[model samples]
Target: MAAGLLLLVCAGAVLYSAQAQDPYDGLPDDYKKGVDLAMEKLTLDPGVRHHFRFLKTLDKSDIESGFGVKYIYHHFYLKPTRCAKGSTVSNAQTCPFRNDRPLIDCAVCYKTAADQIESFPKPYVHCIQKPRLTEDTRTTRTEHCKKMNYNSGAPTLLAVSMPKN
Candidate 1:
């Protein structure tokens, strides 16, 4: 009986440590700040609660990564309908060809297209806006930013979210 109790205690300790070591555990200070900022901003939008359940799923790293911010914007702007079961694709932007097709009914085509895009070089791109500075007679002038491109294959905006630290 004592041996069994000892084994149980040991198993519990191992499980506790495993949970503690999860990748998302102990997020950085910067990440927490980002998340707080995002949450504050999101709270002001009336529709945020309805549309963004995954906001809770996010950790501080997600906000810090900028993916969380983009995700909120993407869903707010695009509002892609969720795919049904057995669907090969999740995002409508990724599968423009089959806009009307039900993903569950046409799994093979969806899968093939999704796979192709996945393998396609630079499938996803992000343009970061940069301010342009110009010299004027009186003072320096700053113009509205231009988009700088970032390449990635993930279809969803979440793909680019904060990397695990």
Candidate 2:
């Protein structure tokens, strides 16, 4: 009877361990390390702390055969540390929309698994707007923000791309 109970306990433990495994465990070691470093920066920034929301995945291995390149892009939004006087915003942890700000795009990329070098390339992060808006720009932004759990008000600001001389 005791042996049966022990077997049951062990089974339960095994199941729990399987469920607790990280979903990204299959990712390359460098990619995982880079993501950790990026997250650390977001949490450690002194002014205007930012948070990332995963946007989409880009698998380029089919096109770029040798390097086994893949990318996951995340966009950063300002974390609300302060509120306007008499503002309805109540959550300090949640980011509120401010018209003056622009969302920053950050790309985490992974190259061939064989490469073991640390800091071969850092995650590419930028606040610069795309040179121009295409027909699909609005649709894409809306979808991305929706995934990020922001309200409808957050993704509506259409950026007007200025012409280069």
TM-score of 2: 0.35
lDDT of each: 0.27, 0.39
The C-alpha local distance difference test score for the whole of candidate 2 amounts to: 0.39
- Please identify model 1 stretches exceeding 4 Å from their true place: 13-25, 50-165
Angstrom error of the Cα, residue 52, model 2: value is: 10
lDDT, candidate 1, at 79? 19
Q: What 10-residue stretch in candidate 1 is worst by lDDT? A: 103-112
lDDT of 2 by residue, 130-150 (tens): 234344754564455334332
- In TM-score terms, candidate 1 sits at 0.27
What is the lDDT, from 0 to 100, of the residue 54 in candidate 1? 17
By summed lDDT, which 10 consecutive residues of candidate 2 come out lowest? 54-63
* Model 1, CA-based lDDT: 0.27
